[model samples]
Target: MSSDDPPYLMALPDPVGAGKQKFQLCMSELLQLVRVHLPGRMAGAGPSEREQRIALRKALGYLDSDYLIDLPEPFFGALLRAAVYDPDPSFNRQFVEPLRVAFGARRTQEALLEVLRTGTNQERAGAARAWYWATLEMVEDIQVRWDQAALREFVVNEDIDVRRCLLPQLPLHPSHYPGELHPLVAEAVHIGRTHPDEYLRHRVELQVRTGI
Candidate 1:
């Protein structure tokens, strides 16, 4: 690690997991919550289903306000999964705040850049989303270097989730990107318009219709 990098950004023991000790512990807890709350094997209604629901409730309860302050790396994946499986509005309320906190942190750019470069597909996708949030929430602190990196990496990203993160942000903040990037952003817009997911297509269409 370079001298300029935050202490939290330095490579740590793999056995300890990603980020610093607090973040690693958070991941461990979230992983266990996911494992424990996973729906039972049987498809039809049964005691297993009942037990699973109870376990899921307990897991949700575990995610209190304090726990949502500085979430784990895996928390993003868990948040997406919770939206699908749990479909609870409370999860949305709990999830977004912590993500904002993380994105607004001092060393977030370095950490997110590392994730974009080396993390798993889901982690990279989450990093892309974090970039979008930074644009909206930490605009003053964000440097042009980070914006340029997003343009270079995400415009042609293989992961659909990663692409989804930046498509709308590009049109909304064209000044952040130079004129040469418009074509690439346009292509992303076209992809978003045709994307199979209804929500993604709607977001793209909204951006286009608004001419932002």
Candidate 2:
């Protein structure tokens, strides 16, 4: 976790510890616990790495059908964001896979798109990262063409995070890039070139070179 993790987390034992303690929290308490504890347990300095993993696993376990229905949209969003912002790439993927299963890809994607369109900046940023990871799984299971429809929707979105997420993940293969996306690619290039953020511009430039 970053040093920036909030102070409240300090009171909670490491998430792994909480899981092992088996406090028998009901779904509501578990959800509330995560809302309070996850940022510190998942994001900040660890009491121990093992404890952190245990905590994450415990939290993911709560996404079972009984608990899933009780989860508020914002709580679900926080779960996705936690997985997306996790520092360890391999572990991040491992942790989020259960979330994907629990949430289901199609519904998760729908929610993410909505967040990208209308949620606050933090939600949109989290949605962008979450969507990128989801696309990684999607690219392999389905034909490349499936991505095109989502790409079309994202390309027109005014949110820079949405475009940033889609542009980098656009398959660098011929099959994925039908000519229809050219205008969108060009538009992205324009936006990227002029964008205030240097990192975003740099990412978009790669698409520019590929001629999208």
* TM-score (all chains, Cα) for each model: 0.47, 0.49
Q: How accurate is candidate 1 locally (lDDT)?
A: 0.48
Model 2 C-alpha lDDT per residue in residues 20-124, reported as the tens digit of each score: 222222223334556564544333223565555566565555435443444344555545655544433344554355556656666556655665556654444
| Residue 56 lDDT (model 1) | 39
Q: List, residue by residue over 1-212, the lDDT tens digit for candidate 1.
A: 35454333111112212223433343344446556443341222223534544443444434344534444566555543332222222332333444445334434455556666766655555555555433344544454555666666565675555555545454434555788876766666666777786656767666656564
- RMSD of every candidate to native, in Å, equals 14.4, 12.3
User: How far in Å is the alpha carbon of 67 misplaced in model 2?
Assistant: 13
Q: For model 2, what is the C-alpha lDDT against the true structure? A: 0.49
Highest-TM-score candidate: 2
Question: How many residue pairs clash (N, CA or C atoms closer than 3 angstroms) in each of the candidate models, in the order given?
Answer: 0, 4
| lDDT at 38, model 1 | 39
> In angstroms, how far off is 22's CA in candidate 1?
15
Q: Name model 2 segments beyond 4 Å from true.
A: 1-54, 58-78, 81-95, 136-166, 170-182, 210-212
